[model samples]
Target: MEELLKTLNNIRSLRLLAKEIPLEQLETILKKFELVVQERKEEEEAQQLVLAAHQEKIEKYKELLKSEGISPEELLEVMNLHRFNPSQHKKRAPRPAKYKYTDLDGSQKTWTGQGRTPKAIQIQLDKGVTLESFEI
Candidate 1:
């Protein structure tokens, strides 16, 4: 992530260096971003492939269940929680838990994460600290 940010900053600096960055330079940066996007798309495609394979296994299991006279719904109930996105496994962290609060003065507010201020704090962030106190 830091490397990506550095690359972005370097690209911005390069753009600023030119009196007017040429279309070719812009295209180059666009191409880099496009490559990243393409990679993500491919990841999603691979996830779909895994999902298909899992579904195929489930179908085979269904056939076995049929042999035992099990109802389709019963089989589905047994496997309901196994349906998960393969793409999600390699992606960003899960969203933080959210909480809504009303202050003593009757103010309404909501925050995310496990902290005093609910901005969806990351694990590395200081726990239970309000946003104002976070700077320290």
Candidate 2:
């Protein structure tokens, strides 16, 4: 009974010690987290700058087209169709299992190419295939 009481007391003491975290350590951890957030924010800002540059280039292209007697409507159509946005497209399609294809090493390798049915990928789709098949 005395040994059990001592064990309980030791456990309680350990719990008390565990709760006593240093402010400096916490501040350091918080500082690291803040740094990560700042880095991510900077990366996003840089991406915005790149997109702005792309817009500027498109404007320049529009100007060039205008000089060549092309109408603004034609330029708008081209820009609308060709504008790139990374987030707008799906990265990959859902897969039930990884398709293992033979690599250079003669070993079974997972499919690196994007698509649903790997074997059914057609370079030029027939009229039967919808335009939606080309998306993402």
Candidate 3:
């Protein structure tokens, strides 16, 4: 973010400089920006060609599978039976317990730290001590 801010300031300085400088120097700077735009356009065209080639190759593979008597659904069933499932292997995020108050018998009282504050905790807030004071 800082680097981008510096670059934006530099461009503003250059724009101001163009007003006081000779026409030839300003035209040169303009031409450089135009060259960068042209280069990006050429790169985009090349990428589109590569993407089309990959799509064509994938279509060819699909035809080959169909000719050999396999449909997409059959392939999916085979893959599902043995595939590495990211979701199945994932561990759920551990929820940190928030206990902010207790009853007269000393049972632990809890909160999930979202939505409207619980009444017991609200009573503490009304008395002027914060929820952090009772956090376990």
Identify the leading candidate in terms of lDDT.
Answer: 3
Go through the candidates in order and give each one's C-alpha lDDT. Answer: 0.68, 0.66, 0.82
| Winner of 1 and 2 under lDDT | 1
By TM-score, the candidates rank as 3, 2, 1
Give TM per candidate.
0.37, 0.39, 0.48
Q: Which tens-of-lDDT digit does each residue in 1-136 have in candidate 3? A: 9875665469786666667889998789779979998999999999999999999999998999999999989998999989888877979786776755775467767776777787777877898988788777
Scanning candidate 3 in windows of ten residues, the lowest lDDT window is: 97-106
In model 3, what lDDT does residue 44 have? Answer: 100
Better of 1 and 3 by lDDT: 3
Candidate 1 vs candidate 2, TM-score winner:
2
Per-residue lDDT of candidate 2, residues 78-111 (tens digit): 8888888777987786554334444444565454
Q: Order the candidates by lDDT, highest first.
A: 3, 1, 2
Clash number for each model: 2, 0, 0
- The worst-scoring run of ten residues by lDDT in candidate 1 lies at 115-124
Q: Kindly report which residue pairs in candidate 2 clash with one another.
A: none
Q: What is the C-alpha RMSD of each candidate to the true structure, in Å?
A: 19.0, 20.8, 10.1
